[model samples]
Each structure stands twice: as C-alpha cells, then as structure tokens.
Target: MAEIKVEKKKPIWPWIIAGLIVLVILYFLFANGDDDEMIDETEQEQVIDTTSIEEENTANWDNNRNDTVGGVDGYLSYIGDESRMGIDHEYTNNAIIYLMNAVQAKANELNVNIDADIEEIRQKAEKITQDPMATNHADKIKDAGSDLTNVIENLQEEQFPDLSQDVQEVKSAVQDIDGSVLTLEQKDKVNKFFDEAGDVLNKMS
Candidate 1:
C-alpha cells in the first residue's frame, strides 16, 4: 500500500458560536453603562438652583423697604409711613421743623418778617428733637403748626392779594391735615407738615 495522508476538516461552527456569545456579553455591558450615564445625567438635570430664587426674594424685600420711605427732599425727610407718625418722635420733630421753615420762607417771599413768631415755634421743635418719646409731642406740633398757619394766613391782603384765596387755601390745608393722613408719610403727629404745608412748599415757585 502506498503511503496515504488523511486531512481532517475543522468545523468553524464552534468558533462562530463563541464569537456570537462574546458579542452578546459586550452589548449587555455597554448598554448597562450607557443607561447608568443617562440616569446620572437625569439626576443632575432634576437638581434645583435656589440661588436665583433667593436673589429674587431679596430684591422684593429691598423694594418694600424703599417704598416705606418717600425720600428726603432738600431739608425734609419723608418721616416713614403714616402708621408710625404718633409713635415716631424723631420724624415728628423733623416734620415740625419743616413746617416752621416753610412758614418763615413764605413770610420772606411776601416781604414780611415773622422772626419773632417763628422763634417760639423753633424752640418747641428743638424740645421735641431733644426729648425721647415726649408725652406732649403731638400737642407741641399742633400748636406750632396752627401758629405758623395763622401767621401765613394773616398776610395783609392789600399787600398780598392772594392771601384771601391762596393763603386761605393753605390754611385750610393745614387744618384739614391736623389729625389726618399725609402722602407716603405723616399722620396724627406730622400730618400738618406733610399733607398741608409740605404740599404747599412743593408748589411754591
């Protein structure tokens, strides 16, 4: 017998099956990693930023605080809100001083001298300013306000033709504001100053 060489063919099906199994395992691992990354991203997106909310709240508070004070104009401070008038002595004193100055200015404008009349009023204002929670603060303001209003009203009509009408209106304004509310500020204490005389002073040209 001649030498015979026999060749055995190896089946490739086992290798193919092994390759398919590896591919399936890799797919599952990668798919799980991608899902985990997506979950982390979703968690980050769901987080809320409170910094902007806090800033907005602070801004609103500042606005409310600013609204409480109308502001100081020249020699006058708005004296806070009307609700704090009677109890707020410092502001009340400031308002009285404003009225006193207004009266003197008006007299000067009309070429009249009221230095003597205003001296007493000035003293009262000084007292209110120095005293803490003065028991008679309201009374002092009322007296001073009335005195100044009368002085302004008594301007000689012959010399000041507007005394009977315009000045009279000013007097009425003062009387009306005595125990009432004024703009953004003033009340039982500084009502005459803000509601009455302050308005007039603002209108004075």
Candidate 2:
C-alpha cells in the first residue's frame, strides 16, 4: 500500500482577519482626514470673514473723516445761496445775519474759537436782522466787516491758506456795503469769493 501524503491546508481565516483589520484601519484614517479637512476649511472661512469686517470698518472710518473735512464746502455753498437770495431783495440785513450764522456754525464745526469781538458783532447783526429798519444797520454791517477782517487775520495761513484769500475778499466786499442796500458790484464780488472758495475746497481731495 502506497502511503498517501496529505497536504496540510493552510487556514484562510488569518488572511481574512488581516484584510478586515486593514479595512478598519483605512476607514478610521479616512474619517479622521475628512474631519481635519473640515476643520481647516472652517478656520479659513473664519479668517476671511474677519478680514472682510476689518476692511469694511476701515472704509467707514475713512468716509466719515472725509465727510467731516468736506463739511466746510457745503456750508459755504449754503451761505452763497442765502446771500444771492437776500441781495436780490430788500432782505440784505437778513442775508448778513444768515451769513454770520453760517460762519459761526462752521467755526463751531471746525472747532475754531471765534474772538469775543466777532461774537459781539454777530449778535449785533442778528439784532439788526430782527429790525431791518434799525438806524444802526450800516454801523452793524461795518462792524461785521471788521469782524470778518479780524477773523481772516487771526486765521493761520499755514492751516487755511486756500480759504484765507477768499475770506479776505469777502471781508472787502462786506466793507464796501456802505448802506443797507446790496449793490450789484458788491454782490458780484461776494459771488467771486464763493466761486474761489468752492474751487479751493473742491480741489482739496
């Protein structure tokens, strides 16, 4: 009888178990990788949003600063309109009063300190406006002219070089108004000041 050699069959379970272990490990690694990617994406988005907010805040601040700086130009236009309207009619006193008010308001806005004499002159102009037929109307106008001159003189040329010249012209025109009437020449002179001041302010930026 020939002895039959029985071949030993290797168990397949070990191979199957090793393959399953590999699959589990792969699954866990892939899952952790996805989580890491999600975290990175979220962090990136947060950074982008934070940067946008910072940029928006900076733009808003610049806009506000520009508006404040440009306020004088708008006020000057308003004064010009009032002056033209008043000069064309019998409300010269009222025009002067409104003009001085504009000046005072602008001074306050710019944090400029008005001299006491200018304030007194402004008050007198206001009173004259309340009574157009006041006997001291001419005197009040002259005093306001003086005040304007003083204001122009006190202003630092280095700080307001562009404005000083126009303001000086305005003072000259105001001084030329000898009576309650606004002459056409004086009106033209005042308008010239407006034109020059507007040009200067527009060129600021």
lDDT tens digits by residue: candidate 2, 72-127: 45445555563443522334443444344444445555567664645576555554
Please report, as a residue range, the 10-residue window in candidate 1 with the lowest summed lDDT.
Answer: 63-72
List runs of model 1 lying over 4 Å from the truth. Answer: 1-88, 156-160, 163-189, 202-204
Give one digit per residue, the lDDT tens place, for model 1 in 88-202. 4655665655556555665666677777777766655455544554455555666667776677556545355543566665566555543333322335324544565555444
Residue pairs in collision within model 1: none
Clashes of each: 0, 0
Model 2 worst lDDT window (10 residues): 61-70
Please give the CA lDDT of all the candidate structures: 0.57, 0.54
In model 2, the runs with Cα more than 4 Å from the true position are 1-77, 80-94, 115-118, 134-136, 156-158, 162-164, 180-205
Give candidate 1's TM-score.
0.47
